[model samples]
Target chain A: MKDVYFMERDPYAPIRHCYGISKILYEGKSKYQEIQVVESHYFGKILILDGVVQFTEKNEFFYHEMLTHPVMFAHKNPQNVLIIGGGDGGILREVLKHKSVKKAVLVDIDKDVVEVSKKFFPTVACSMDDPRAIILNEDGFKYIQDYKNEFDVIIVDSTDPVGFAHVLTTEEFFKYVFEALKEDGIYVGQSESLHYHLDIVVRFQKALKKSFPIVDLYTTVIPVYAGYWWSFSVGSKVYNPREISREVDVETRFYSDEIHKNAFLPPNFYQKILNGNFKY
Target chain B: MKDVYFMERDPYAPIRHCYGISKILYEGKSKYQEIQVVESHYFGKILILDGVVQFTEKNEFFYHEMLTHPVMFAHKNPQNVLIIGGGDGGILREVLKHKSVKKAVLVDIDKDVVEVSKKFFPTVACSMDDPRAIILNEDGFKYIQDYKNEFDVIIVDSTDPVGFAHVLTTEEFFKYVFEALKEDGIYVGQSESLHYHLDIVVRFQKALKKSFPIVDLYTTVIPVYAGYWWSFSVGSKVYNPREISREVDVETRFYSDEIHKNAFLPPNFYQKILNGNFKY
Candidate 1:
């Protein structure tokens, strides 16, 4: 009974520390689930279940900085960008910072995630309602299949590759992404961890390499993820997102030109794989 | 008692479910703690602690690749080098890969770490007993203070700069590191994480920038550390590590000429801090 109560209270929290959830506020919405700031005195909480960062409080910049700057700055010119699965609207907010960006389309499976994020995580999930922002609630992979080769940069800001998002990392999905981009387009998406999912990352990297000219793997520290350090496979053609330049002036809090280049720097394992030693 | 058992079963582990521990199989007497891959079904147990990796199942090129290739290839002909706290000898193995090395010195507070590593984790810690290597058990900070204007490269492979190792990142310590290096020496050290320990990283970056002319922060995926995405800070006196030659033919598994340049690239928070935005 206690465990069940704990799960209901903080289902997504670290198992040992679930008892510490302290509700700040909870407000209901018609379309979206709800907006709340359920604080965990021990570990921070940001209820993004339906794709929203609903309870973000302490370190929003950590996630925003990591997911945004690396992919955006890696390209020489990220004028037209597409965000897949980031219904929370955080990616769109970051995309608007680049002066070179002329348009950004956010395609998420659920519209509720965007609505919830806009209402709760205002600091990061802002700009969801921007006029240039086109919100399409549908399967991101399917959307990309029909979406022409219009985007220079594609940021796949999906959740854990489990449940509905699991198919996002498949070879078929990546092939579609490859077809959806311009010649020099770059694809950046979450690829999980170095500890539990090295094989998963290896498969994704190998698959992306098969499809793209350059496949670079980089990681960032996210408290909620399985290993906290999450990997990202950047599939590129002709242009490395890191090499691209945007003399564009944009006010950014976490990502910069320097960080942009470092984001593509692969960890030790990938470096070995590139050189043909996969034993790690 | 069960909780304590779990904690001890995975003492250094910060997370559960995705965490596992492998026994050292050997301990004590040399510089610091040393271990072997007695267990570990997930990350494959080829453990690398204190810069010494044990190759129980296969060669651990990933550890050496992530640590050395990035830095060495980035530098222009690094002849003289200093290693702070890498007593376990894995770094020594990585450094010895470059034929350009004229001299190498490794300093650790505890010589036991070096000794145990020398005995058990040999393949990854190959150069621990090298005659060309100058191994010292004295404090690295004190060693740096004594050698003013001595080395071309300095690698700080110390434990996290908290608790006992906290002084390593202080302004005084960085000043000593700056003084110990030649006019063009480059310094790199583990800077913790961007997820949980951004404050510490930012502080270290601030201190390094003040101590050295150019500073860059980068990361690698090490599952044991917080966020799995561990941070690294590079400090240079007169030259950028990026200017180093890309053709260092070290028999490495991870770092390549391209990876060296990529290592110097910063992610978003790295750029933000370097550009003077430390809020996030």
Candidate 2:
């Protein structure tokens, strides 16, 4: 068989990441965006939304684990956990691994993304049937406005901050997130690539710093992403993700006790990034 | 001007990185390989050897600093340093930063690679003519066999472990390297990408472990590299690269004392990688 490549062009970056596609397993347009499930020789199944790689079966764990467990393990008692915009169920799967988590709520506005993910990615969408997971097919921003000091940990797994997910990275949304969290709640979100989106990361940190007492950044390499050095921003009322408060007895290939401590950028990186004093 | 892209294809990985090029400044067939210097709108000047990108002016510091300083700082005093196959002189520039380093020698077999770099990449090749820096255009393997416990630090910034550079990553060459370093000396080399070249990294580490008592891995991200998580293998007789023995007082855009400590992999990663106990 000849080869076919999917070129995922970044909106602003001067590079276009090309992925080899073996076959198109499923292709259809959702209400908010076009969706496709494709088979890759190296990466197994890949989920694409609006010509952007959402995740692949081979390395989704890097993105999902880094985004989920750091915040989950940071809090001393993360009983009530909330994941925003992770319709793919990968975050839910990771969240359910925490024994301390009593109720895990997942909120995504796009119901079609959830339906498609459930139909195509069974292993990645594995935790949908778990007893503790609560699914909400509604706008997370509107849904979050009604709460006050509710969740112990809140994670935003939204797409890049250029679309409907744009509001989620704003000061107003962070203020809403501040109101929705407990006195000691921790908020974590994908802050995009630190190499390509340093401006966006600093913006997110600045906005979160207004509401949360502690804000820092950590990153992991996801091969599918353009810059590969994908960043995750953390906002906490008390816990600093660089230091884990709880002992991790969970099963994870990438995030270990050492990795948790090592994943964080040194204080100098945050100083340079947040203060807009650095350049790539 | 119309846009042109330089497509970098890895022999194994499924992805081909595309960088936007403004113009091809020079193209010629060297005695050993074909070389081209191209100007990029985003990455400044890019040096490509035989269709593979050597370094771009934009982010070479990420690679050069990580490969050089980890071991350089780990050594209490690195008076004499030797570099193998770093024709581009990025490593030489970083080696001269240490105040303790008195004599820095760079040996690359390809004279054209050095000549081309000196012409097109003046800023990156800035330290090639420094009083303390020495250039030797000769076969490194032959030159290395003459030394016995002479150099304080030896760095192998060779190309990927393919073609002529293959010999540099073998057990035999590591033995030569082990014999060439003083009792308290340190060694470092680019071990390729962690994601795409895990087996190569493990193999290099395993080989170095035979001759050196302490061997570890460190990495930095390069956007030009297929896998942005680039790995550098360190072998030392007395120094542990994770902890620095000397204070770093260099003017760098990327490397700092915090970065020096942060660049090395956590102990768990080394354990998992060395035992071949993990998979991506």
Candidate 3:
């Protein structure tokens, strides 16, 4: 007998991926979305929300390190950091690596995701007990409206632009994010894939450009993701992401000084993407 | 009713990908391998050989450009080029763009794959009619043993190290390739993915290092391939592939001057990979 678990990336398209499920660890419905945790033969512990893969223990470091470190290292002195929609605590783990970070606050809409992650993904959720860490069980969209120039670095580690997370990609929401960040604060988020989600990246870049002084895009390959060339969008008020201002002293599997310099897309290719002339 | 075509990347591991096939253009078995062409809703026309996807019309440029141009431009003057196992003519098309090239030779074991590509993939196979092109239906292993110091550049565009193509990755075969090249000649081939096929890459690099003076590795992202981050192994005699020696005069969708510099993996990461310490 063979066991297979398939996840459809898009309902309208005929593309799907499957993983050999060794065991089903947890399954339930949160107030916001469906949650699932499973053990796989290849990727180890896997987390799924609303039928989309969030992270796997095998390669979550690529996504978490690329998402958090680029923007964190780009800033000069990041003390107060705000993370939106990362209940899995992977982002929190990477943020706490910086010694200069005095406070790290995470606001997530789903409390069940945190509980499930703490139970199944203990390594990723280990940093939640740190004294400098703060967890808020509230909607990120509603929580950011109250913050005004309170953070040195704001990282939005949200899901795809669908369901309850849809508003997180809009221009109005970015305006609130811009206002919530300090005058010299930096912001970064998971923008989506350059293969299948170029439109979303372009829309988010346009919205971010309207509120920030400098905006750029970088990419890293995540094997289990639907589109392998995962992208991230960065917006800065006074710093340039191309130059790393701080020393990387943390122990990492993928992030490095040379990778930080080479991760950004080429200027010509980025211009084509911005002009909507990118072939694929 | 729904139409679906699934391709399992590995038999031992439970990982598979599928595409919604709107139409099947051709399906037949040759003396070498099984060939199929299908019209996909998202990827347009896709070519599959022996249940593995070779390329798709939507993103073939990423693979072809990355495979052909890095070595082509790295050399001072590539007047004569030989491509082994590229029956689809995509690599041939990119090679013909340089006016300095006087002859382009392509050899493949499967004649049926060439016929199917010319008929179903006309755009990619367009350069077959060029006066400078030569096509041979013969096995690459036996054909290269007779040549010595013949070509300026030799590209082994063969499939994965399986079935009839398995001999192409052996040390004795690379010895023949080293003898078949000029004093400063360059050699490059499609190495497997870094995510799943790292062992094959490590083995191939070890084999190539015995014959060539300088061996390097680079990567590109192909969305439809089983592993998105595809690797390429290059062996050079004199020139360093990290620097471009000539100007790129061809029109391309993905390859650029800046991309040539950024496409290679960072030295630190490559060292980790060579040391067998890469976690992901």
Q: lDDT of all the models against the reference? A: 0.65, 0.87, 0.88
Candidate 2 reaches a DockQ of: 0.78
Q: Provide the TM-score for each candidate, comma-separated.
A: 0.69, 0.97, 0.97
- The worst-scoring run of ten residues by lDDT in candidate 2 chain A lies at A1-10
Interface RMSD of 3: 1.7
Error of 2 at B207 (Å): 0.5
Instruction: Classify candidate 2 by CAPRI docking class.
Output: medium
Instruction: Encode model 3's per-residue lDDT on A1-280: one tens digit a residue.
Output: 1466645464422457777777878989999988999888888989998877888898899999999999999999999999999999999999999999999999998999999999999999999999999999998999999999999999999988877888988889889999999999999999888888888889999999999999999999888777778889999999999889888888788898889888999898899999999946
DockQ of each: 0.23, 0.78, 0.75
Candidate 1 local Cα displacement, residue B197, angstroms: 3.7
Backbone clashes in model 2, listed as residue pairs: none
lDDT of 3 by residue, B1-280 (tens): 1567655464322357787778888989999888889888888899998887888898899999999999999999999999999999999999999888999999988999899999999999999999999999998999999899998899989887888888999999999999999999999998888887888888888999999999999999877777778889999998898889888888888898898988998999898888888845
Second chain TM-score, each model = 0.81, 0.97, 0.97
Off by over 4 Å in 3: A11-14, B1-3, B9-14
How would you encode candidate 1's per-residue C-alpha lDDT over B236-261 as one tens digit per residue? 87665666555667776546656565
